[model samples]
Target: MVQRFTISLDAELAATLDGYMVKRGASNRSEAIRDLIRNALTLNHTDKSNNCVAVVSYVYDHHERQLGSRLIKHHHEHHDLAVSTLHVHIDHHHCLEMTVLRGPGEAVRRLAEATLAERGVQFGHVNLIPLKEHGGHHQHDDGANHVHQRPAL
Candidate 1:
């Protein structure tokens, strides 16, 4: 199903939207608007969901005293919520890490906040997408059998 509608924006706002669409590589104004609406709605809905998957990213100085060990311990504290982690060496003194987390939304948010609150951590960000729990069996075209337990929005 699709819905068609019209909207009016002031000249300055319209021009700003156009520039944003171009910068975001949206290809068309309609698609850009749709993406913006979807993102806003998703953020609102995800906040109310009980379960979600999140990507937590942060940068820190590798030279910070015991920072790496503290981070590892923090992740260990929420081991069940952790899906995976990627570590990157940004430079001799800095490192960037992104961790994928899945579990209760509140727990995930708490862990992300605790990590970001640690001394020396900077540029921390967490993007969480709500997940819908489901129960079903699935079979792939390649004859692989699987179960559908969690679906993300």
Candidate 2:
């Protein structure tokens, strides 16, 4: 069942939303609004699921008072979840790193929060995928018959 509601917006905000809808090729206002709400909910996590993968990207000062070292150490501490990391030197004073993590949703969320909370870190973004845990360890007659699932949903 679907419930309908009416929302009133000012002229400027409505125009801006309409512009976004037109630029993005969204089918309708409902679709665009649903996507925007989904994105906001994705970032504002509140679930404690154990089957999820998340990509945590952030920018920071690489030489900001041992921050880089701390970040590296943190990754090392959770090596199982640290799937891969991409580092880029944006400029003389800025560094960007995208870290892909897989494990419990809570663990990944905590790691992202911790990294983002560090001093000198900025513009942190995390994308999470919730997955169904079908008992990672499965038995099979053939070793190549098993298929793994993607991180986070």
What is the lDDT, from 0 to 100, of the residue 98 in candidate 2?
Answer: 94
Q: lDDT tens digits, residues 26-68, model 2?
A: 9888878888887787667647865677888899987799999
Q: How close is candidate 1 to the true structure, as a TM-score?
A: 0.84
Q: How does residue 119 of candidate 2 score in lDDT?
A: 91
Cα displacement (angstroms), candidate 2, residue 75, comes to 0.5
Error of 1 at 124 (Å): 1.3
State the lDDT at 53 in candidate 2.
75
What does candidate 2 score on TM?
Answer: 0.78
Give the poorly placed runs of model 2, Cα more than 4 Å off: 1-5, 132-145, 149-152
Q: Which tens-of-lDDT digit does each residue in 1-153 have in candidate 1?
A: 999899999999999999999999999989999989877865554354578888999999989999999999998988998888899999999999999998888888888789889999977988877777775787789999988666645
| TM-score of each candidate structure, all chains considered together | 0.84, 0.78
